[model samples]
Target: MADQAISGDRVSGIEDESDLKRSITGKLLFFYVLGDVLGSGIYVLIGSVAGAVGGAFWLSFGLGVAVATITGLAYAELVTKYPQAAGAALYVNKAFKNRPLTFLITFCMLSASFAAAASLAQGFSDYFSQVWELPPPLMIGLLFIVVLAVVNFIGITESVVANVVMTVIEVSGLVIILICGAIFIGEGRADFGKLVEFNAESSPIMAILAGIALAFFAMTGFENAANVAEETIEPQKTFPRALVGGMIAAGILYVLVAMTAALTVPIGTLAGSDAALLEVVKTDILPVPLALITIVFAVIAMVAITNTCLVALVTQSRILYGMAREDVVPGVFGKVHATRRSPWVALIFAAVVVGALLAIAGQLAVGDPAPGEEKTTALEILVNVTVVFTLFIYGMVIVAALKLRGKDESEGTFKAWTPLLVFGLLANAGLLVYSVINDPTSLIWCAGLLALGGVLFLLERAFDRRRSESV
Candidate 1:
C-alpha cells in the first residue's frame, strides 16, 4: 500500500499519505483537467481542421469534442474505479505483471509526451518568429526545452504556479474570441447557421472524423490528471468529479471557441493560416479596436502551452521512474532526486531525447510536402510516429481497465468499473484504426516505436531472468 496520513482530528487510522502532498481540491482538479484538455492544440492546429473540413470547422471541432468526451468518460470511470497514482501505466503493470509490457506502455507514454512537446516547441518557435527572425529552429527549440527543464527542476510548486498563471492567461484568449465573435455575429458580419452546416456536398462523416484527430490533440491531457491521484487530497472522491466535470467543461469551452472563430473569420481564411486568432484581430471583424488585444491573447496561449509542456515532461519522468522502480527498464532509471524526491534521471534522459528531436527538426524542416514526396522535415515525419505511439498507449490503458478488475480487491473504495473501461478501449481502437489508414505518416512511426519497444522488452526480460537465477 502507498503511505498514509491523517485528516482533520479524526483517528481513521485509514489516512492517506501526507508525504508529497498535492492538496488538490475538486476546483483545482477542475483547473488541472481544464487546462490540459483545453491545450493549445487549438492555437496551433485550428488551421489544420479548417483546411480539412473547409467551411464547417466548428462542426469538426464539435465532432472532436464528442469523440474525446467519449474517451474522457471512460477515463473518468477507470480512474474512479481504481484510484491509484500510476494511472494507465500503473493499471497496465498491475494487469499484466510483465516487466517488458509495462516498460513499453510507460515508454509509449514518454514518447507521446516528447512528440507532443516537440510539436508545442515547434509552435513556440513559430510564434517566436513573429517577434524575432531566428534562423536556427534547432537553437530556439533547445532553448525552449532548456527553459522548461529548468522550471521543472526547480520544484513542483513553481511548475503548478506557472501552470495556473499560464492557463488563466491562455483561457483569456478564448474568452476574447468568444466576446469578439458575439459582437461580430450581432453586427451581422458572421452567420450562426454555419455551425450546423452538415452540407450534402461532401462526405461529412469523413471530414468530421479527420478533424476529430486534430481536436483529439486539444483534448490530450485528460488521462494525465489520473496519474497525479497520489498527490490529491482524497483519491477515491476527488479524482472522479474533477476528471469528468473538468473534461465536460473544457469540451464546452472548446466548442464555443471553435464556433466563435468559425463565425468571425472567413472559412477560406481560417483554413489557410494557423494564426487564425491573429487574423481575426487584424481584420475589422471584432470590436477590439486594438490588434494588441489579440497579441496578448497569443502570448497567453503560448504561456499556457509552455506550462503544459513542462507539466507533461514532469508526468513522463514520473511514469518512467515508476516503471524503472518496478525493474521494468533498469535500476539506473529508478534513481530519484535526493532532495526533491522527483525523478531526476528520467527527467534528464527525456530532456536529452526531446532536445535531439528538436535539433533534427530544426535542421530538416521544409516549407511543404511535395507530390511523390513525404514531409521534408524530420520533425514532421517523427511527430506522426509519435501520435501513433500515443494512441497505442491510450489503447493499452483502456485494456488495462478491464484487466485490473478484481486484481486489487483490497482497495474497497471505488467509482466507475471495468465495463466502462472496455467500452473506452473499443472506442479508442476504432479511432486508432481510422487514423492509421488516413494518416500514414503517423502510422509508420507508431509501428516503428512499438517494434522498438518490443525489442527492448525482450532484452530487459532476459536480463531480469539472469539476475533472478543468480539470486
Candidate 2:
C-alpha cells in the first residue's frame, strides 16, 4: 500500500517529485518533532502560566497536552492520507477545493509562523541579556533571525542536524531543574500543598482555562512537522509514530518541568519572574556555583529558542513552495535553488517578514508609559497573537480531516478516531474564543496580518491574469 502511494505521488507529480531533498529519516524526524515541540515556550512562558494559575500550573500543561494530542491524531491521519508539505493549507485545499479559503488558511499559517518566530526571537534576547549586557534586545533579536536564516539557507540536512544538537542541550537544562527540585524536596523545603492551589483573583475554572491558552504555545511545533512531509524519508511509515510519540514525550517532560518549577520556588517568585526555570536553578539546591549555573542555563534557553525558530522558518518556506506548486500563490515562491535545493525565494521572504514584524513590534513598544499606565511589551502581544492564530489553524485542520475521511482509504494509512477529532475541534474553538474575549488587542494584530494576506492574494491574482492574457 505504501509503495502504491509513493508511485502515485510520482506519477501525479505531487510531493515525491519535489525539489527539496529527502534527508530526514525516521530518527531525524523524531528529534525534529521533539525538539520543535519542546522549544522556547516552556522556557519563556512558564512564568506567564504560573501567574495565571498559580502553583497548580502543571495541570494546565497536562490539559494542553491532551488537546494537542487530539489534534496530533488528526494530523497523523491526514499526513498519511495526503503526504505533502503546506500542512494545514494542503489538507484544507484537498478537503474543500476552495482556492480563496485555501489561501486564507495558508496565510494564517504563515502569519502564525511569523508571529511565533518573532516571539521566540524576543525570548532569545531575554535569555541573551542574562549572559551579557552588550546590545539592546531588539538588535540581538534581529541578529538572531539573520543567523538562523543563514543556517536555513545552507540546507535542510544541516538545519535538522543543528536542531538535534540544540535539543540535547535544552533538554539537559530542564533535567537540571528537575534534579534541583528533587533535592529541595529531600531537604524538606518544598511546599507540595501549593501544587493544588489556583490563583486567588480568578475562579479556578477561569484560571485553568487561561493557563491552558498560554501553555498551548508549548505544544504547537508538532503541526509544523507536517510541513516537512515532502522532505522526510518514507513519510507514510515514519510520520505517525514519530509525530504522535514525540508529542507524548514532550508533554510528559513539560508537565514534570512545570511541577519542578512550582516545587523549588515560591509561587509568588515564579509568577513574578520571566525566567521561571532560572529561578528554580537559583534555589541553590544544586551543588554548582550560582553564577556558573545561571550563565549555563541562560545559554541553554537561547539554544532552545533557536531550535524552534529554525524549524518555523523551514515550515514557512515549505508552505509557500507547496502552495505555489498548486498555483494558489505566485509561481516565484515555487522556485528552488539549483545546488542547495532549498526554497530560496520563500525562505528569504519568510525571514524578511519576521524581521519586519520584530522591528514594527519594537517601535510600537518604544517610549516610556505614563505612571500607572501598565504598558504591554512586544513579546506579550506576539505571544497572544501566536496562540490565537494557532488555535484557529488547528481547528481548521481537524475539520479538514473530517472532510477528507474515507476519501483515500488505503491500507497502512493511519486513521484517528472520529469522535476525538470532533472533540479536538471544539477544544480549539473554545480556547480561541476565550483568548480573543480576554485580549481583544490580539484580534487587531490578527486582522492587520490577514489584511496583508488579502492584499497579497489580490496581487497574485492580478499577476496571473496578466500573464495568461500575454500568453
Candidate 3:
C-alpha cells in the first residue's frame, strides 16, 4: 500500500500533502497523530485538576476523556471527509457559506491559538523557574520565544523531527509514573477508595461539567492536527486515526495519573504548588527514580507541548495568509517564504504577539509594576474566556463537518460520517453552555473580543473594496 501520511512515525510527510499526488503508510499516520495529540496539555494541567476536584482527581480526567471522545469522533469524520489545508476555518466557511462566519471561526481560532501559546510559554517559565532561580518569567518567556523562533526558522522538517523525539521521551515518563504507582500499591501507602469515588457530585451536574471543561483543555491538540492537513501525506485516513487515538490515550493517562496521585498523596499537597506532579514523585511512596523520571517527563512534556503550540501558531498565521489570499488583508502577508516553504511573515508576526502575551503573564505572576499590574488577573480572566472562545470555534467545526458532507470526492478522502458530527456538535455546545453559565463574566469578555474581531474583519474587507474601487 502507498503511504498516505506525513511525519513517518511522527507524522511529517515529504512535503506532507495528500491527493492523487501523495500518500502515507497508515501506521506512520497513526503515530504522527498520536505524538501530535499527546503534547503537553495533560502534563501541565494535572495540577489544576487536583486543585479543583479534590481526592477523586481522576474524575476530572475521566470527564475530559468522555468529552474528548465526543469531539474526537466529530473531528475524525471531518478530516477523513474534507482533507483540506484550511482546517477549522475552511470547514466552517464551507458549512455556513458565509465569509463573516468563516472569518469569525478563523479569528476565534487564531486568538485561542495565541492564548494557548502564551499559556504554554508561561507554563514553560514556571517549570524553568523550578530548576533555575533564574531571571523572572518575562526574561524566561522571552528567551523561550527566541529559542523556538530560531528552531522554527531553521525549517519545518527540523521542528517536526525534534517533536517526534520529544513525544517518545515524554510518553516514557508517563509510563514510569504508572510503574511507580504500582510500587506504591505494594508498599501499602496507596488508598484505592479515594481514587474510585466521585464525591464531588454534590456540586451539581453543571458544576461537574464546568470542571470537565477545564479538564477538557488537557485533551485539546487533536483539532490543531487538522491544520496540518496541507502538510499531511494521507491526511484523510491518517488524521482520523491519529486524532481519535491521541485523544483517547491522553484521557486514559490523565485518569490513571489522577487516580494514583489521589491514592498516594493527599489532595492538599497536590494543590499546594504548580509543580504538583513533582510532589507525587517526592513523597514517601516512591523513591528518587520516580522524581527523576518526572523531571525527564517534564522536559519531554514541556517541549512537546511547546512544539504543538508552535504548530498551532503557524496555523494562525496561515489563516492570516489565507485571508490575505482572499483579499481580506494586504497581499504581502500571503506570500510564503520561497526558501523554507513556510509562512515566514506570519511566523514572525505571531511570535511577537504571543511573546508579548507571555511577557504580560510573567509580569503578572510576580507582581511586576508595568504590564504586570493587570497581567496576572487579566490572564486568569482570559483563561476562562479563552475556554469559551475555543469551544465556540470547535462548535463551529462540528457544524462545518456536517455541512460539508457532500463536497467533491475529487477534493479529498474521508468525509465525516454525518451522525458523528451531530453528536460532536452537541458535545461541544454543552461545554460552551457550561462555560457561559459557570463563568458568565468570562463569556462576556469572549463575546466582546469576538465583537472586536468582527469589526476588524469587516473593516479589512471594506478597506480592500475601497482600494479595489480606486484602482
Candidate 4:
C-alpha cells in the first residue's frame, strides 16, 4: 500500500477536542518517554540478562534498544497519523476494522500492562526489603500497586508531575553507578576484558538473543507514551521527536550502566542477585560510607520502579477508556470522573487485576528449570509473560502501520521508514518465538491471559445482543 500524509490542521483539530487535560508539554512528554523506557526492568532484570549473555550483556541491551527504536519509529508514524489514545489496538483497529481482532489486541496490551506493573511491584519489594526487613514481599508489592492506583485516581497532571520528579531521581541513581565505575577503574580494580565475553554454555548468537529478550523489557515503556497521545499538546509535532529521542537516550544510558556493572563487578555476582545494580552501589571503591550509599541507591531504585508502574497504570486505564469509546469493550470502561477527568473505573479494574496476578503468581510454580538453570520466581515468570505479550503487540503494530499506509495523506504526519518497520516485525517475531521455545511456561501464561480476554469479549457481545433485543 502507498503511504499517506496527514495535514497539520486536522491533527490540531483532533488534539483540541480531547477530553483529557493537555497538561503534558513537549518537556513532560520527553521525560514521560524517558522515564517509562528507563524503568524498573533494568533495575530488576539486569542480572537475568547477564545470566543469559555472560559479561557481554551490554551488547544485548544495545541491540534491544536498536530494535525497540525501530519499532518506536513505527509508533511515531501511527500516533501522529491517528493522534489519539489506545495505542497499538487503535492502530490495528484502524487498519483492519475487525472487532474481534481489535478486542484481542486491546486485551494483549492491557494484559502486558498488568504483568509489567506486577513485575515492577515485585522489583519494588525486592529493593524495599533492603531498607527494612519487610517479610512477605508479596504484601508489599500489593500495597505498591494500591498506592500507584491512588496516585493515578487523583488526576493526570498530578501523575505526570510525580513521574517527572521520579525520573530525575532515577537518572541520578544511574549516574552514580557510572561514577562509581569510573572510580573503580581508576583504582585498578575494574576488568574491562569482560565486555566481550559471552556465556560459554551457549553459542554467542543464542546467548545474546536471550539477553536481548530480557533486556528488551527495559526498552518497553516508550510505547506507553502513545496511549497518552490525546493528552499530549500538539501530538503530531511533539510525539515524533520526544518518542524517538527518549528511546535513544534511555538506550545509551542502559548500555553504559550494563558496561559499568560488567566491569566493576564479577559476572557471577551480578548474574546471581535480583538487585544487580545495587551490587554496584555496594562496591567499596566509593569514597562515602557503603551503608549510606546502599540505602540511598535502594530508595532510588524503588522510585524508578514506582515511576514505571505509574506509567503502566496510566496506559492501561487509557486503553480501556479509549477502547470503550470504540465499543470494543463495555461502555462502562469509558466513564470518566466528573472532576478528576480520569478513568476511575478502568483504573480500579486494572489495579485489582494486577493485585490478583501477584497473589496467584506468587503461589504457583511456573516453568521448570533447564539443566543447570535455577527455578524461576514469580517476578521472572511475569517478566517473560510481559515480554511475550509486548512483542506480539509490537509486531502487530508494525503490520498495522504497513496496512494503514496511504490511508492518511494530510501534510505534517510522521512516517517511519518502510524497510525499518519490516525489519522490526521480523525481529519482534524472532524474539517472541525464542522466548516461548526457551520457556514454554510463558506460552501457558499467555494462553491463560488471552483466555480471560476471550471470556470478556464473549460477555460483552452477549450484553450487546440482549440490549438490542430489548430495544
Q: What's the lDDT for residue 126 in model 1? A: 58
Return the TM-score for each candidate structure: 0.84, 0.90, 0.83, 0.91
Misplaced by over 4 Å in model 4 are 1-23, 156-160, 337-341, 365-373
Model 3 per-residue lDDT tens digits across residues 127-154: 6666665687567776787676656766
Q: Ranking by lDDT, best first?
A: 4, 2, 1, 3
Please name the candidate that would achieve the greatest TM-score relative to the true structure. 4
Candidate with the larger lDDT of 2 and 4: 4
96-212, model 1: which lDDT tens digit per residue? 888667766777877778777777777666555544555665677678887877667767545456556666777787787778777787788777777755434458887777676
The TM-score between candidate 2 and the true structure equals 0.90
Give the C-alpha lDDT of model 2: 0.85
Which residue runs of candidate 1 sit more than 4 Å off their true CA positions? 1-22, 156-161, 196-202, 284-291, 339-342, 361-368, 372-383, 403-423, 447-471
Q: What is the lDDT of residue 438 in candidate 2?
A: 85
Model 1 error, position 169 (Å):
1.8
| 371: Cα error in model 4, Å | 7.5
lDDT score of residue 457 within candidate 3: 63
lDDT of 2 by residue, 235-276 (tens): 788898899998998899999999989887888897777577
Q: Distance (Å) between predicted and true CA of 357, model 3?
A: 2.7
Q: After superposition, how far is residue 454 of candidate 4 from its true place, in Å?
A: 1.9
| Candidate 2 Cα RMSD after full superposition onto the native fold (Å) | 4.4
